[model samples]
Every structure is written in C-alpha cells, then in structure tokens.
Target chain A: MFDAEKFIDQQVKKVRDEVEGRAIIAASGGVDSTVCAAIVSRAIGDRLLAVYVDTGFMRKGETANVDKMLGRLGVNHMVVDASDEYFDALKGVTDPERKRKVIGEKFIRVFEREAKKFDAGYLVQGTIAPDWIESGGGLRDTIKSHHNVGGLPADMHLKLVEPLRDLYKDEVRKVARALKIEVAEKQPFPGPALAIRVMGEPTRESVAIVREACAVTEDEIEKAAAAGEMKLPWQYFAVLLPVRSVGVQGDIRAYGFTIAVRAVDSVDAMSAVYSKIPHDVLERISTRITNTMKEKVNRVVYDITDKPPATIEWE
Target chain B: MVIDNGGQWTHREWRVLRDLGAESEIVPNTTPLENIKADGLVLSGGSPRVGLNAEAMGKCGEYIDKSGVPVIGICAGHQFMAAHLGGKAGPSKVPEFGKTLVSIDDEDDLFKGLPPTIVAWESHNDEVTELPPDFVPLAHSDNCAIQAMKHKTKPLYGLQFHPEVEHTDNGYEMFQAFIDVCQAHKKE
Candidate 1:
C-alpha cells in the first residue's frame, strides 16, 4: 500500500535536514506551495521565510487570498509589490519559452534580493515531480519549461531546496490535508501565473483581461458545482488567445480577443481529460467573461480537446 | 523596458532590467509605443530583424525626438536607431551569431563598471555599417565593427551584441550602467 502519511513524514524529515539554516520559499498560495510552506515551517520553524512576489500576473484577488492563507498557516511571510517590475519585464515578449525563462529569471532575481534582505542562504520552491519531468533535460522531449524548473538561469546564486519536488498534485494535496492546511482542497495554479495563460506578449492590459475572465470562469463553475449542476474539475481557468475576432455586443460590431475557458480532470499534470462541464454552466462562464471584460474580450470559447490531442494551456 | 525581437535573450534583458530595480514591461513589436510609459527605453534583440513598420520602431523614433527619454538600442534596435537617425543599416559582410569578443574604444557611460574586450551574445544578420553623423562608435567586434554606438550628445545608445544573455559576462553591469544613465537623466 502507498502510505501517504509515511511518505510525508519521511519527506518532512529529509527537508528539515536538507534546509539546515534560514530559507526563503516562493509561496504562491496554491495547494502545492502552501503545503510545502506548511511542511517546511513545521520542520524549520521561524527559520523559514515565505516570500510572495505580486507579479501582476496573478489571478483576480489572488494576492489578497494568498495573504489571508499565509496568515492562516501561521507562516512568516512577506509580500513584495513587484507588479510594475513584472509588467515591465514581460513587455514585448511573445514566445512561451522566452516568457517562462524571463519570469523564471525574474523570480530568482527577486527572491535573491529578498533573500539578501532576509539574509537567507537557501531558496525553497514548491516544485513537483512533473515540473522537472516536463521541463525535459535528458532523453525527455522538451515539453514546456515550468518557470520554477527549466526556466532557471545557469548562474543562479542561491542554493535550491524543493520539498514537494517528488510529489504529484494529488500527493501534495494529501500532505496539505494531513497538515491541516486550509488550501488543501484548492485548485492547482502554475508558478508562472497568468503570464503563460496570456498568449503572445503578456502586457498588463492583456493580463487584466485574462484575470477577470479566469475569475468569472472559476466563480461560475464553482457555483454550478456547489448547486449540484456538475462535479467540479480538478483545474479550470481562462486562456486569452493572441488573435482577435469579430463579434456583436448589444447589436454593435466589436472586435476583441477571444477567451478560452478550460476545465480538466487529472491525477497528475502529465495528462488530463477535458471536463464535461454542463452546457448551462459553460453558458454562465461565457456570458460572465464577455459581460465583465466586454471591451477587451468579446468572444468566449470552450476547449473540448482532451490532453492527448491538446494541452490545457493553448500556448 | 526592453522589447523582445523574438530572439532568445529578450527575456534575459527583461530580467536584467527588473534586477536593476527599474520597473519594466515587454510589449510586442506590434504594440503601439505611445501606450508604454517608462523613464527610459531599451530595445531588446531578436530574430526577423525589426521591420520599419514595427510599432516599436516608430515609437522609439518618437520617444527620441519628442519624449526626450534616454534610450538604449540592442542589436535590431541599434539597426533601427541608425536607420531612424538617417544612417544606413543592412546585411553585414559576415553574419555574427553566438559568443564573440568585443573591444571598447573609449570610456563611456554605457560601458561603465565593465571590463574591456568582453564577450557578448551576438545573433544577427544585419549590422549598422554606417552611423548618422550625430552618433559615434563606442565598441566593436572584429566581424561587425560597430558593435556599440551612441549619439554624440543625445541620451541615445546602441549595442549589436545582447548584453541581456549570459554569454556576455558583464552584461548585467552594462544594464546597470544604462539604468544609471536613465537615473541621471531623470535628475537632470
């Protein structure tokens, strides 16, 4: 039998010894990072510093939510107002790899500066098994690089310590639940945040458009799930496509970008099946995204393609 | 902020700018330049050498002539800057790509806090062979002699090699120097 408790206990011990001194963690308030932060805080106590960089690529209310979650976890944390910096860094970048690499390097640089301020030597990440696996080093074909893994620069200064590096999403959540973390049931969010979700160059305006769209998707889907309309999928969000389309809004011709709502069920990030969202729920999502971001996003789309044929993220 | 030209090191340039404590943003070549607001501007390197209609190029010219913000053009941007300033730029005699050594001609604000004859990431088919009479060469590689140049008096500069990529050992230092120039200009 695969004993999750035993595994978590052993992993916690290993992390405790590995991160011998003061360490700084990139806490994104996601289940993985939240769980990792909890385990590491239990192991290292006050020696761990949880640093959250508000890259302005976060989902709607994400920064506030993260602050609340971190407060609840009783983890020592600091939030840096790096939205302007991130928006600036991502300006004019269109390629997915380049965006990931830039975001990854920017993360390290920010963490490095924070680490210096905190006088910490170790950098803790919520990197899971699939991150490195998909980031592709050896014989593995290059899947997309996870900003936390493959996007790392070769000349990184701080030493890395990833506690959840070997666990999958399900396993990490299990550990989170075991540790009594509040976000144990929370959906997964990529470390690169909305930057990758926004195709082409991730400008602040584009990111804002996607953020509202994603929030609407999540809200409607969750409302549908809660009302017993359908089962909530493991992951669901909106992707802002690079191309623009013509549409009618209140009998007026409008040309704006299309927003793709994707919901998927998966055990690990290696593969996923598209969620069979109820048509009414999808309707609500489509209606909400267009209504909320009517100016920027005029068209709403539902991604029915499964993982084998298509990845959750269009990029 | 730096603009990605679809080249590999555009992201690195963005990171360097952020690291130097300057707020940055990346806009696509198609993004209207008027929408971007920064104390200064950095034109990052990339492939498919910047086109004349590239919204960024038009904006760069506008910023230099009107905005009066300090601007640093890298590779494609350098070519565009030269072309915009009435200088001629096209294909180089020999294309320079990958690691190449560069020699600094004289101590300038751009090369501040960096060693001479430094290695930088070079990936471009086009090079600025001639400079506008108002601009002067500051650094050069053997194949592409006009590796780095700046306006004789204006707060404008250009580099043929990518200082954002790791191939350039002192690339970050160069960025830091540029940011310093911007800061000085802000004070002025």
Candidate 2:
C-alpha cells in the first residue's frame, strides 16, 4: 500500500526544507543508508557528503566493496578507516549494550572530525523504525541499544536527521527499488558489524575466525539459493560463540570454538522465524565451515530460535 | 486510534490502519480520555508485563471503560483487557513466541472472514488465563487457552497473536475486518 514515488518526493522536499546548509550522511552501503544517501544527495546535491567509516568490525572485504559502491552512486563520499580506534575502544568490552554504545560514540567522534572539514552541521542516518523501537525508552523496555538510536551519546554537537525513521525494512526496500539503488535487496547488517557477531571478548583472533566462518556460511547459502536448492533467506550469517568444544581434526585432538549459523525469514527486522534451509544446503555449509577452519572452529550448528527467544545477532 | 502501550508492533498496528485507508494515529495510552477522537480504538501490546504490573499500562483501563468505541486489544493489551474487566491474566505455563497455530473457536466480528485455523505470529510472556464475565473465548492455541476473545454485546475484541505483522496469515484481511467492525460501530 506504500507509494514509493510519493514518499520519495515528500522526503526530498522535507530534507531540502530542514537542511539549510551542508550535511554529512553515515552511509553504511546497506539499503537503508545508501537509499538515504541517494535521497539526501538529490536534495542537497554536492552539499551532501556521504561518510563511510570502516570500524574494522565490518564483513570480509566490506570496506573496499562499500568504497566502490559509493563511487558508482556518484555521491560525494569518503572512507575513514577508524579500525584501530574501534579495536582499541572495544578492548575488554563484552556487554552487548556497551559495545553498541561504544561503537556509536566512536562513530560520532569520527563523523565530528569529518564534519569539521566538510563544514556540515547536520548528521543524517539511515535509522529505520526497528532501530529505535528495539532500542526502547520511556514506556518501552530496552530490548537492545541499537548503534544508531539508544547507543547515541546524550550530548552531541551535530543536529540529527533521519529520513527513514518511521518506515520499516520492507518499506525501505520499496524506496530502494523506486530509487533504483543497487543494494535494494541486501540483507540488513547492524552498524556494530562483526563485533556483535563475536560473543565475549572481540579480540583480533576471535574476529578473524568469525569473519572467515561468516564468509563460508554466506558463500554456501548464496550458492545453494542460486542453484534453486533453497529460497534465499532474508538474512543469513555465522556467529562466533565463546564456548569451546572438543573435536578430532586429522586424527588429532583439536579443542576449538563453535560457530552458529543464523538465517531468518522476516518482512521487518522486528520479528523473525528461523529459515528452513534444506538439509543438503545446511550440511554443505556446516561441512565447508568445519573443513575450512578446522584448526579454530570444530563445531558448527544452526540457530533454530526465533526473535522472542533469541535475536538475529548474538553478542 | 491505535493506543500505544509501548509495544514493538504498536507502530505496525498504526501502519496497518493507514494501509487500509483509515486515518489513524498512534495515541499514547497515557493520554486523557476526552482528547481521543476516533470511531474506534486499538489497545497495543507493551514491553512491560501486564501480568506483573498493570500500572505500567497507564490510562488504558480508562480508555476501555469510557472510550465508547469499538476496541481491539493485542498481546499485553489483550491480557490487560481481561484483567481490567475482572478476568485473569498471568505468565503462561508455556509462553509462546514467533510462529504459532491459532484455531478460531467463535469467528466473531474480527475473525469474520478468517479461516478456522490461522498461522498467527505471537510473542507474549503473559496471556489471558480466565474469561471475564460477558466475554467469550474466540480462539485458542496449543499452549494458551485464550488466544482470542470478544464481548457478548459490546464491540470489543482481543487477539493474543499479532495480526498486524506481515508473517501472520491473513493479517491484512483481519485488519480490514476490524475496520469493518469499526465502521459498523460508528454507524450504530
């Protein structure tokens, strides 16, 4: 029932009216932000600068891929490699909310520096409905402090602007299609990125293991979906759990970590059901992960829990 | 009017109404009774456990008592409705989440066009345990006894599962049926 063309026209006008001068958008190269960047660019033209920050917690090759993506969109953009700062700030931080808050504050600090050079006063985010709803405040209970909303510091210099605040992920995708953006159907990724995917301490070693496992999980799922073996899940990835299990690798006693393969089907990120990936596809994913990372990951299990019992991403 | 009790799907309820071509807005449950102007009202679910704390539900009790419109309660809202009306609501022995199969027992005004059994999405820590006087059970799931209920005379309804969410089967039609109920109540 949502009219994308009408929504786009109204949003462009609203952005033009609200933003008097220059603005810098936190473009994550995801559907919401990229679509946001496109709309903001249309409104402010060259006055809008798309700032993509690589927090060292992104997916494999995510930073470079986003870099090329922004170039193609023809939006004035820059990539800030704040990986070291993120890694350092997140050291010894284990709480899920704490990680989101820390990453949020760190993102603002990076954006502040960028804004000073670009002379921008407005900070545009691709924050959709679920981000704030799940974040919780006032009467609502805090489900999780999303990096964009509840994780935001109380005191910040930039005036916030979110064009997609009321819309959900599916609605955002509709807008993305209307705008003809390349990442229209991309899976929703948290702003905290791979940091939340790794449970407990997100040290360099843990992050690397999860990243590799995630890559393998994604590869196998995508391949199986392409081959018509299974429908592509709304979102799919691997989670690195802290608990260790014993296993036999190449006839040697190998003690290693476990990787949880998560895939869900949902219209919006608010509620989700575990994806019914075919047994053959799941076996392929499990075999590939254990074989590819035999030294570090010994066990791989699929997450069957739903949203109420378990969220999409593990802390 | 979609009364906001701070539930996650509260906005989804509002969106459903808007999509159905109804001019609807999400009014806080705390709002004064007189300020609300609508042909019907929807009591939204909340994060706070209605079974444990009813005060967190704000002025929802007042809205149900005096709003004088067709009303539908969901999740926590549904639980609060039964409790406020002298029924019983508490933590479910087997709380349901995500996917659930709800069997319609009455097919009241809200479930007019819906099938006897529907795949309803649910996320409730608490549920209506006992039927309030004059209220009849309309639906039930395997775990919970009262999945749906309706008043014998008044235009009131409650659903344990979320019909506003996309994953729910016939969610849109259910909303349209509610809209029809609201319209019929407005005429009366």
Candidate 3:
C-alpha cells in the first residue's frame, strides 16, 4: 500500500523547491493531470497555471467538464481552443507514431504561447512511469510512443518538471483519492486523446463514430458495475478499427466500421489482463453501439487479447 | 530481487515487496548468478516468446541451478522454470488470458491461510503440462493443470497465473510467503 499522504507532502515540497520560478502545466482533467494540478497548486498556489487545451480530439464535453473541475479546485487555469490547429497538423496522418508526434508538437506550440502569456519558465506534466517505460529506452522495446514521452519536440524551450514521473496508474489513483480529487477513479486517457482511438486517419466522421461508441461502452459498463452484474475494469474504451466489415441491416448489405471494446484489469499500466466482462453486459454494449450508430458502425467486437500481445490502446 | 524477464508487472512485484518492507530490485536474467546477491528471487512474466525463447530468457537457468535462493516464477517465467527442470510445456490447448478460478489442490507454506479456491489472474498462451522431477503440483485452474507447483525439497515455486496483478485474490499474501521463505533461508 502506498502512503499517499507522505508521498503527497514530499512531492509538494519537492516541486516547490525544484521550481525556482512560475510554471505552466497541461491539465487534461484525467486522474494523472488533475492530481498533478492539485499537488502543484498546493506547492505554489498562484504561481502554477493549469492550461486545459481543447483539442478537437477530446472526448465529448471534456473541456467544459474539466473547466468546472478546475474551478472547484480553485486553481488558476486557462483554456486554449486549439482544435483547428490540431486538425490542420494531423491532416493526412495515419500512422500511430506520426499522429502522436504531431499532437505533441502541436501541444508544445500552444503551451509555449501560453507560457509566454503567464511568464512561466517551467513546464510541468503528469507523466507517470508507464508513459516512458512503454515508450522504450535503453534495453526496453518501444511498444508505443506515448504523446508525452515519445512525442516530445526536440527544440522545446521551457524547462520540464515532472513530479509524478516515477509513479504508475494505480499509485496515481491512490494519490488522487488521498487529495480528495473527484476524478480519482477516472479511466486512463492517452495524452493524444481520441486521435489514437481512431486507428486510421482521424477525420471528423471517423472520430464522431468512435466518440459515440466509447460513450455507449462506458455507459453500459458503468451500469453493469452499478447493478452488481460485473466489476468495473481498470480502463475500458472503444477503438475504431481502420477496416470496415460486411453486415446485413434490414435485408440491405451494409458495410460499416468495426468497433472493438477493450477493457482490462491491471495494477499498473505496464501489463494488463483483458477483463472478463459478463456475456450479458457485452451483449448490451454491442446492441446499443449498433443501434445508436446504425449507419456508421454495424459490427461490434470485444478485444480479449492481453497487454503483452496487444496494448491497452489498439494503436 | 526480481529477475526482469521483460514482464509487464515486473515492477509491480518489486513494488509489492517494497510496500511490504522488503528490499528488492529488478535485475535482468542476463546478470551472472555470482553477481546476484539477494534473499529471494522473483522470476517475472514476459513476452510470448519467453515461454519458448532461451535467448530472450538469458541466463535464468544458471540462476535457478546454481543459486539455492528461494524463487517464485510467474507466468512466462513459470513456463521457463518448468522447461528448465525437464518438464514439458508448449502452447496450451485451452489458453487462459483473463481472470479464472483456481483451486488449491494442495497446501504448503505458499498457500498458508489462503482460501482453497481463488480468483487468479492469468495471461499466457502456453501452460505447463507436466511437472519436473520432485516438483509436485500445488494448484490447478480449469484450463491449466499446473497453476502452481512446488519443488519437493528446494525453496523453488512456479505459478502459471500472475499473482502480481490486482485481480488475483491473495496475491500479496503469496509474495509475503515467498518473502518469509527467503528470510528463513537468509538466516540459514
């Protein structure tokens, strides 16, 4: 068990002592970022500026929801509407590595501009241990390029300060709960957001399909957990496959994209076993997905592959 | 000490020990047995090939053969441990990749005070079909027969399922058991 209070106090002082000047942090409202925001706020209350960028790739109503969260925490925050910027940069990009890199570069540019406005000299991120481990270095193999680690720009101007870099997803949640943050149990969302969830070139249409499928998946899964049908997974989401499959819809041959619902249980993000969701709960997710997005997504599949062969994220 | 077989929960195993007040580090199997100095050794789970790849497993064989330290092999590490000891293991006919109910067929120091049946977490394509010489079976799941095994006299053990993961009930207790075994040997 992690002594979260001791860890928090040590980290608060560490961040305070390390950062000589004002710092700007990327606050994505996920557990990692939100926890980091809360901790840094405790360290240097007014000096820390939490920047929540509204990338068009975010989940539905995320920016607005996060805005309310930051308000409750009493942290000084700035919201940047850079969805247009991200869309332009990610045009014609299909490769997972390329997408992450583009998003990272775009984020840095936005953060750099915001840092200038706040006169902040350091950039703090909620980057945990798994972000860099899977990102690969030394003898480690690169599973995937996490936007924060693999996607960082070479010529970044601001100095970096990552307090939570050594902790894992589970430990971060413990700290979040210790700090009384509401998003403590929030599922792990990639820094690149829904862009990676859409395997192919993330267009407006493709992203829209995944966004809704993901919403339905979460809705059904949460309902199942609430009703005592099944335990909640550590992380669960819907991934939009690059290829389409053939299916019949009311006597008409309909070809639509396939959505793979991935849920896994893990103490940390390093390795995970696929969650054994009840058959009834799976049927509900499949039915609701096909019914809601009838034209866009006709086929619903469950990813039973574990983390070794297949990462939590499909990409 | 934890042998890094490139397993995903290699860190978690180490964390469990650290949280339990055990001093441990994730050391690669390539490190010579003489270079390793520790009370216990945790052989961690790794890639699909670790179940079959010798080079990927590095010098794990020598460590188990040379060192008399108490060892607990998990997942791929468990498969390799069986294979090194003249047991048979290959692609499982009914591969288990998620949480499964495991029944403790026999009890020893490892399963002390634990329930007879446990919901253990597993993620592997291969399973140990036979036990090595003198290593008796301790646990079994619906799909895998050699879910847990113990060497007759030595302080060596293997777990087909991953106890380092959260889903497995009594995971921490098992680690503490192995840790206690190591502590006893340290005094010996």
The digit string of per-residue lDDT tens for model 2 on A70-136 reads 9999999999988899999999999988999999999998998999999999999999998998899
- lDDT string, candidate 1, A1-315, tens digits: 234687678877988878766889998998888888888888889999999999989998889989987998899999998988888888888999888889999999999999998888999999987787567653233567888998888998899988777566777777877788888899888888899898888888888888888888999989999999999898999999988999999999999999888999876654466889989898888887788788888888888865533666766
Q: Which is the winner by lDDT between candidate 2 and candidate 3?
A: 2
Per-residue lDDT, model 1, residue B183, is 89
For DockQ, candidate 1 versus 3, the one ahead is 3
Clashing pairs in 2: none
Cα error, residue A209 of model 1, in Å, equals: 0.6
For model 3, the stretches where C-alpha displacement exceeds 4 angstroms are A112-121, A138-141, A153-159, A216-236, A242-255, A258-295, A298-311, B28-37, B51-68, B79-96, B100-105, B113-118, B125-147
Candidate 1 off by > 4 Å: B1-188
TM-score pick, better of 2 and 3: 2
Which of the predicted structures, 2 or 3, would earn the higher DockQ when compared with the native?
2
Please give the DockQ score of every candidate, comma-separated. Answer: 0.01, 0.68, 0.21
* lDDT, each prediction: 0.80, 0.90, 0.87
Q: Which stretches of candidate 2 lie over 4 Å from their true place?
A: none
Instruction: Give the per-residue lDDT digits (tens) of candidate 3, residues A1-315.
Output: 578999999999999899877999999999999999999989999999999998888888888999999999889998999988888888899999899889988888899999999999999999997888677754456778888888888999999889898788889989999999999989888989899999888888888889998889999999999999999999999999977899998899999989999999877865678899999999999999998898888998999887655678887
Give chain B TM-scores in order: 0.91, 0.97, 0.97
User: What is the lDDT, from 0 to 100, of the residue A175 in candidate 2?
Assistant: 97
